[model samples]
Target: MRWIWIDRILEFKPKQSARAVKCLSLAEDFFADHFPGWPVMPGALMLEGLAQTGGILVGEANDFKEKVILAKIPKAVFHREVLAGDEIVYDVELLHLRKEGATVAGKVLVGAALAVEAEIFFAHLDQSRSQQFFGDHNFVFTGELQRILGLVREAGKRPEQS
Candidate 1:
């Protein structure tokens, strides 16, 4: 099953930065096995959330022309345990964007407290090569993610109900 970790895209600035949020709940599958008595959100998943956020930012920079993939994670540090009901905000800033790859520094926050932080790197595959290797389906930024992005942006533009 394809997992879309982040719940919503709160803000996005093309080629620069983006912020996304995920609301954790007890019903999450990982909670069952992560810790039987005390459930905690896995650090790896949170990292993935950050990567996904940054990856989308990078993908949008070139209008989704190249297939973006997480190349490497130079660093990652977890400050505290993330529990169910916590809302994690992933803030990612593009450090470098090159023809072949990109890098982003990111932070995952629970409210004002920092939960995790790291540097994520992404590589852009040649369009023609990727299509041949992966059968032309964009694996990284699927329509599901893009749809959520558009919906969130549109919601932000709408007038709030009085």
Candidate 2:
């Protein structure tokens, strides 16, 4: 199954920034093992949410021609624990964007309080290079990714509002 951590795209600005949210539910599988008595969202999963948000922003900035992959996480910090029923708002700002890769500064907030912050770097892989290694069907939801991020308005429609 595809692991889509973020639930919805609240807002997006091409080549600049994006805001998205994820609501953790009691049925989340990880909660069973993360902590038996006191369930909490894993820090790693929080970072993954941030990366997924930033990765989508980077990919959209390039029209999804290049496969954006997290290469390095230069910095990450968690200020508090995230629990089930918590809705996390991820705000990511692009620091730089180039042919090779991109960098972003991100923050995760629970309501008005900051929960986590990170600096992420991602490498852009050429489509041909990726296809050679992973084959054509590897990314079954490339279009879906765009749709989830609000990059694509509808089927056969041009990406809306940049």
Candidate 3:
């Protein structure tokens, strides 16, 4: 499944921070199986959402030269459950970045309340290696992600400089 965590980019600061949103709906596939009677978004998927947002920020910061993959998730905490009809606003800040890896701190907010917070880590790898790691796992960027990237670029007011 092509899981797109971010629905839109509300704000973006190049090499610094970004804010994006994800609207949860009952129509989403995961909700169908997560729980029958009472559905709650999975914590792992929440982490995935944060990772996706943070990875994009890192990739954009580096001009997407190397494919940024989630190498490890050193720390993650779920403060609350995200339910259908909730809009999760994710804020991510670049904590550190180097040639081989990067770290980001992210928080997911449901309205004004914090739902989840995590410190995510990513490793930069050659495209070929990344492809191999994914191993036929089809990951396609949804239109939402493209739109967010557009907004991020616009907000930054600069083309991605490698």
TM-score winner among the candidates?
A: 1
Candidate with more favorable, higher lDDT: 1 or 3: 1
lDDT of 1 by residue, 17-136 (tens): 999999999999899999998889999999999988998899999887768889899999999999998999999999999998899999999999999999999998773256566776
**Candidate 2 or 3, higher TM-score?**
2
Point out the worst 10-residue segment of candidate 3 by lDDT: 136-145
Off by over 4 Å in 2: 127-141, 151-162
RMSD of 2: 4.8
Model 2 over residues 85-152: C-alpha lDDT tens digits? 89999999999998888999999999999999999999876533665686544263376667786542
State how far residue 21 of model 3 sits from its true place (Å).
0.3
Poorest stretch of ten by lDDT in candidate 1: 127-136
lDDT of 1 at 143: 85
TM-score of each prediction: 0.92, 0.85, 0.81
lDDT of 1 at 136: 61
Task: Give the number of the best model, judged by lDDT.
Answer: 1
> Which rank order by lDDT, best down to worst?
1, 2, 3
What lDDT score belongs to each candidate, Candidate 1 first? 0.89, 0.84, 0.80
CA lDDT for candidate 3: 0.80
